[model samples]
Target: MVAKMAACTGSKDGQDSILEPLCFPEQPASSTSAPSLQGPSVELLVCLFCPESVPLRQKDVLLKHLLLDHKLVIGDVRLIADLPKYMLYWRGRFLEQPVSDFCSVIKTNSTGPLEKQEDYFLLCDVLPEDRILRERLQQKRLEEVLEQQQLERDDSSFHRLCMFCSEEFTGNRSSLLNHMAREHSFSIGLPDNIVYCKQFLDTLQDKLDNLQCLYCEKTFRDKTTLKDHMRKKAHRRINASNREYDRFYVINYLELGKTWEEVQSEDDRELADDEDDDWSDWWAHPVSAVCLFCDHQSETMEQIYSHMKETHGFDLHQLRTELNLRFYQQVKLVNFIRRQIHQSRCYGCQETFECRDDVLRHLVAEGHVMTLPDASTWNQPQYYFPTYENDALLCTLSDSDEGENGETSHVEDVPVIAEDVSELRALKQSSVLNQLLKSRGCSS
Candidate 1:
């Protein structure tokens, strides 16, 4: 079949045609079943109360005029489908009855001490007629959008020359839409996802012909200036806030009684709401801290220490008291013991066994629990790390400055043991570890 004008308009004679209006060959509309975006619709929103007000193609302009001048506010004007028609219906009804009958009056804006407070009218779905009108318009808009979608989907007479280049496309609306998107970087959306293809293009072409920027709507002196402004400003698309163009996209009409934006955000809203309902109290449970030497595990650090002291005869409290271990020293000592036991070696004598049970038996039978290797051997810099990933025993290690009455001690994140390393004599004589280091020398 020969291509006809739908998306783009030109008498394509196999050459680069100028962007101009072309005729669409007549096709059966099935009048009772389909609605078209052709002919005059209510494109301009007129003030509902004003008799001689300027016609506003922009909804925002019309909305502001109504609020400031007429003291009327239309609720969620963006969400309202067929905004002009909705306003027109109310304009006619305002003449028939008192405006206060269908609207809620809010008295505000006191200009002076002598002047009376002005009353502002809120026209929303609180009234039954307003609710029914919104629902009816939404239902009508959805039906028309759906029918237009089917027409474009089955349309075969799509022919047009590129607005930016000399490329020509014939048959399948997507071919022209895709080419424009791929070559010129102009995309309204996927061809199948849009309705009213002809009207959408015509609206853009009219703006280009008038030398107006599609995004900013500023009029330029010439087509060259307009082209430069659009390209430089990255304005290759229509104005998003202009609700007049909402009828072209199928997404805006996909849902009833809700905006497309509201529907899309439901998942995010649900996740946020779920986070507020936390069950931290019910889900709380104690994670066990493992013993330093053996496989003995307890729920708390205190319980683990008690079990190790009673069962394995490994008194860590006695060692800390004798050595006057600081916060980091205790951390290193627990890690050192843990590393040695994991390698199936006794921390006391440094003797390797086939398994952990064999090492535990050797340590117990040989009475090497209190007999530790030289301080120089185990007190290397590498022992600062926790050998176990979530070493629970390290959590109970207190600072040397902590009082015997269970008072908390001041300590920084980094260990302060090396802070007084300059005073070698005092460190060597005061702590049992330094004394052991001197006595044992290099022997383990």
Candidate 2:
């Protein structure tokens, strides 16, 4: 018996439409051909869109064909409903089934109403295998975007801002510290709350593209030009008066060769030594003086200057320019130490005492001596005089009456005198007898 029903269709109003019947031919009976060993063959879905009625065994392949060839989406409800016109047969059944019957069957199997695109696929049972994979990929992309946003937020949170000028900085702690110290004249010992700002550091980097002098605030095209300017202007000597403050930074530079604890131990040892012990010996020591640029050391300033010039192509001025920041800080510290040292007070402790002696006592008791060891020697003088032992010249000190008295005084081993010192006293004193005779109004 042949059973016929209207083909499924969809109207402009999104309602089902009845259409003419689509034919399905029955399998021919096997007479002369041998009976197949297999049971009833698996049914194939056929596309009516092709004149040949192309057969696809798998639903996924049919869906891909519909999408790729027919330009139809599998899961779309209206499209799926309208698809019966293009579906000659499904599972060996003619496409002449009632639209309501197909809808009813799908509604009976699925949990929800057939409203969404995925729901239509679920009803039709042609959902792709990689559909789940696509969803997981989309979900993974969303998670990655969220994680990147969170990291950006956290990074912004760590950025530091200047308290005084309300400027922003993007650099790390060291760069921020250098900026604060240089631009704002901000002390190194800032309050813990002060922070670096992202904006300021970025701006500072842009500004620094042109080499600028930190001391004179002059901008230069390159380092060579800056060096020339520094040499001609004598800008390196700008920190000469501030060497006391520079001394601390120099000490800090030395400390970089070793750990803080090690430097502290060395300082302790030095402090424990006797007062009469020549502190000049420490000046010749390796740890005491190190090159600002390369950490090279020597006994005297002249040797260090020579080393810097020969090895690093840096003269004294160039070396000083390189170490300008250290010199700047040193000047400030020296001034502070001088002020506090003479005031009979401890700057770190902020305690006042009656006399300098009492202040030293307090400093020793509170361990401030270790902290500001330079303060103890603030009263001492620092002198630099170059001596040449090889060159010598001799001159005699004589009374005017020496020739008349047939007596001559000769002196040997005197250094050559570059300038006249005829009015000055001789190195060797005249005899007291001659001086007494001269003073007593008697000729020697």
Best by lDDT: 1
Report the lDDT tens digits of candidate 2 across residue range 1-444.
111111111123422122111222122222232222222225455652453333333556676765567444434322231133324433223246433343322223355555532322122433342234334444543343334333332342345665335577663344455556566554433222222223323434443445664346578988778657755775522232332222122222332223233566675555665666766655441322233223245546556657756764445334223433232233333334434543445645656655555655666577664353333333222101101111010011121222446654243422233333433345223767778887999876
**Overall local distance difference test of candidate 2:** 0.39
- lDDT values for all models: 0.72, 0.39
**Model 1 regions lying over 4 Å from their true place:** 1-32, 39-71, 109-115, 182-186, 205-245, 256-263, 266-444
Root-mean-square deviation (CA) per prediction: 24.4, 39.7
Question: What TM-score fits each model?
Answer: 0.44, 0.16
Q: What lDDT is reached at residue 151 by model 2?
A: 38
Task: Residues 1-444, candidate 1: write the lDDT tens digits.
Answer: 112213132122322222222221223344335555454464777678886344545678778888888889998776677887898899999989989998999877566553677888999988899989999999988877788787777777877766667588777677788778877888877776788887787788788888888889999999899889889999987777786677778887877546556667677654555556776556654666766565456777778778888998988888987887776777888877766666667778776665667777889899987677887766766678766556667777876444688865556643555634545667657778766777989432
Q: Give the best candidate by TM-score.
A: 1
- Residue 219 C-alpha lDDT in model 1: 99
Report how far off residue 375 is in candidate 1 (Å).
Answer: 74
